[model samples]
Target: MAENTRKGTNTTILINGQRGAAYIKVHKRRHIGYLGASRMMASSTSPVDDSTPSPSADASLGLTKPTTHLRIKHAPFKLMHPTYLEDDHTTAQGTQWHSRASRKHLYTVKLAKVHLDKPSTDAEKATTSEFKIRGELRLRTCHPHSLLKPRLAWDISFWVAVWFVCGSAAWIINGFLLFIPLLYESSSQGVQAAAWGFVGGTFFEVGAFLMFIESLNSGHEELYKKALRSILNEDGGTRKQERGKLRLFGLAPFRDIGFLGSTIQLCSASIFWISTLTGLPGVIPGFPGTSSVAITDVFYWTPQVIGGTGFTIASVLFSLECQKAWWKPNPSSLGWHVGFWNLLGSVGFTLCGAFGYGSVGNSWMNYQSILSTFWGSWAFMIGSLCQLWESIWREANT
Candidate 1:
């Protein structure tokens, strides 16, 4: 029994010894594995330091030593094996740092408010204000070149002179025609013929002159030049449309001056012609020819002549108003002043007074004759003279 017991104890001791050896081996191997893993992790976490100086620093400040304390973190997985992982991480980090540094260098911190340090002076303020006022005036007024051009001035002067001269001539001719007939043996017949001629001639002359003036004042060339300039000057800038409305429309004061003048001329011519045509006997009671003509005819002819003179006076006054427009300092207003007045005079004298008078008296003696023969002629003559002075002024200025 003792021997068997001893043998069991020996076997137990051997088994325990074998178990101890195995545990020691496992512990040592585990420690060695942990040590290897730690070395790999430490190397992976460490950063590479560059020995080159930063290019962004000023070279004039002197050369700077490369920084050595700088470190970069690297991945452990890359260190475990030879691979392209380290290269990619290095390139990406380098690019990111370079971009960040560039951004920092681009911005400069300005320490002073430079613009606030300067204040405007009184002279500068005055100059700026004056400039603004001048600019506004330029925008509102007509173009300088357009107004000052010699052609426009010449046209205005020519038309005005023509109207004045023609109107005066018509008045003088009508008077002559009416009076010459009264000096002959067949006074009645001679007067009648002269009267008809006077009225007819006035109408034809005035109409022709007016038509000519209208043709000359077409404004086609001026408009074409303006349009051409606009097209050539366009260069992606904002453009404003130009206006083509007549200047007289805006200038109300000068509106009726020409009309008044023309009316005077028309009335004066009509009266002289009608009186001559009717061949009313002289005031002598025993005078030769028929007294059958109505008393209305006697009174009518006299008033017609008187009324025409009144209209002529009014025309003279209105022409003075037109002259005012021409004298304005603004050159742009000059053309308009001349154009509208000329138009008014032309239409009122020729078309309304002269042509219109011919259609009156029913080819013998009509109501229109009484209205036009005296008043129209007188008005035209006086108005024309007034315009004559205005033209003279314009010419002198030129």
Candidate 2:
């Protein structure tokens, strides 16, 4: 009985020890699993926390924090998995996340929104629309020919007027000084009038010549430069061509007038000096000459008397040419009003020639006086008319 009892007790004790060992094994396994789960959660959360600061702290500091910690979650499984052992990726992500987050926290802030009301007044809107319309019109109207032609013509005309006015003034002053004495002696009212008319006419002629030359030179230079820049096959400025034709065909004859005037002045100057020096009979047939058929007579007669008729003929030809230039078949060519004035000039020249022939005794004097009177009166009247027309046009346009 005692042995059996001892054996039973030993058996029970062995069974209890086995159960305790099993229980201890289970408890250790459970504790190890919990610790492993906690370690894994801590590792993941640690990297996330390191990457992003607390949102409340960021907001209070007026910062914008980056979510770089999220990048690790998006990385390829092969890199995150143990099989790949992507040590560099892990380190790089951690570093980038922390740096980006810190910088964002320091500087990033939200921008304030701005709202603007639309224009309130009808008048303001209308003004804006008008300005826009005008701007569009200006842009659309930027044509080369339309823009350049009028401006160039105006410039050329201005220079022409300046030269004409200056030359006219010079001629009048010089002629009056030279002719005052002769005017008193000539009892023939016609001769006296012829002398005064010649002086006045010469001034106008000189002005015309100077103005023509200046206009031609400036116009030619401008046209030449413009041609170089113009498209190879295009018709550029025709003002140059028209002006050139006028210069060659119409104005060329007047060049003779200039030559005649220059010669007369030279001869007159020479005679006056010679008479002062030689102490010869100063009372020539023509006060400046010894006889009516003296050196002075020849000098004065050849250009002034003879050339005057030639000048008139030239002026008529020029008027016709001007008509041709301005009144061509093309509608574009018909704008210039200068042709009418040129025609009028021709008429004045013809009338002057008739009157001069009747008044002057010398053939040369008759020719010169008439020629001078025609051109002078014509240019003055036409130029004045043109000026008036221009002023009116400008006023109307404005």
Candidate 3:
């Protein structure tokens, strides 16, 4: 019929006319680690006619059958107990009740049927059912939704990026190092490098394509557009504003920095692969002649310049992403540090290409060019390995 609760304790009184009896409910907060206090309700029948039972007497009675009429009160001295006042409260009525007072912790409110010594009537059973339903609703309100997990497509894209880097290494080692030197001696040697470059470039392209897809799937594109719209005031007010340039060269502006970098890198791979095809022996026929030499010099060195430039920009972007904390830095940002090596490789390749074209017969110039290109490839390989480590670390931490 009535309820009274102190700051730390709650008491519920139930009055029943069937047997002219009463019931009391006492709920105390307890600290039991992650497992919230049990939801089982203790029912007890009064052994003596008292407004509130004595501590020693209540302890002696333990838990008894709950009756219809009751008067519940807090034990003032129990405040000294460790679990006595830790922000917990419980209340129940026809169809509404709540427990666990503190916002700091989440506790599920559940109702367990309190078995009575005698068979319960329809009215009592209905009351019990209402308690269960209300308790379940309260639990749902406590924990609304589950946390989002990383998607499988994102993971797949990451692995593809890894493979793309590996392919680049294979292409450099097999195609350029092993095959390119023997180009004038035998056209067949060029085939090995061409095949490997194709394989490597294909993987790189696939990875880059997947990155684009993942960016869309992750909702970064829409976020970028929303940000653009806000900054540009695209909704148009009383003042007319210039239209924001959200697209570049008729394509969506790449708001995903990593994806943009990867796309550029893919373009670099394509140019370099195309260079491999053009420099093959059969492409020009008269191997060491002036015209053939001129063609070879132009075709072979030109793509390196373009590719190196793209790669340099991409490496810088990747490094910036690390600085921005977009990609979790691997223990003091190993990936960021590793990217410097790739940047160095880009410089090497760029220099190699710049000086390579006109000085084909100049032994010293040719030597410097080959040496620089070699350094670039190895540096890029090392950077790729560092990236791989970063990806592995990210997966493990997640």
- lDDT (10s digit) by residue, model 2, range 1-398: 00011222121000011101100011111110000100011111111122245442222111222311111111111111100001122353221211111111211111111001132333223222111110000000111122112222243334434433443343344334334434464333334444444444544454455434432332112100111122112221111111122242132222122223223333332332232222123433444333444454343433343433443443333233222222342222121233244344434444543443343467556444445443555454554355333322211111
Q: Write model 3 residue lDDT over 47-119, tens digit each, in one string.
A: 3233455432232222232211111111111111010111112332221111111110122232211221132
Tens-place lDDT per residue, model 1, 1-398, is 00011222121000011101000001111210000100011111111112234553212211122211111121112111100111112233321111111111111111010010111432223222111110000001111121222222344334645555565565456544443443352333434434444454455345434423322322212211111123112231212323333232111111123333334444554454453334334542322233333443353334344533444454343334323222432223332333344334333333323332333335333333333433444544554554444433321121
Q: What would you estimate as the lDDT of candidate 1? A: 0.29
lDDT of each: 0.29, 0.28, 0.42
Worst 10 residues of 1 by lDDT: 133-142
lDDT of 2: 0.28
TM-score winner, 2 or 3: 3
Q: Find the number of clashing residue pairs for candidate 2.
A: 8
**What's the residue-level lDDT of 18 in candidate 2?**
10
Please report how far candidate 2 places residue 102 from its true position, in Å.
Answer: 73
Q: Which 10-residue span in candidate 2 carries the lowest summed lDDT?
A: 133-142
Q: Sorted by TM-score, highest first, which candidate order results? A: 3, 2, 1
TM-score of 2: 0.31
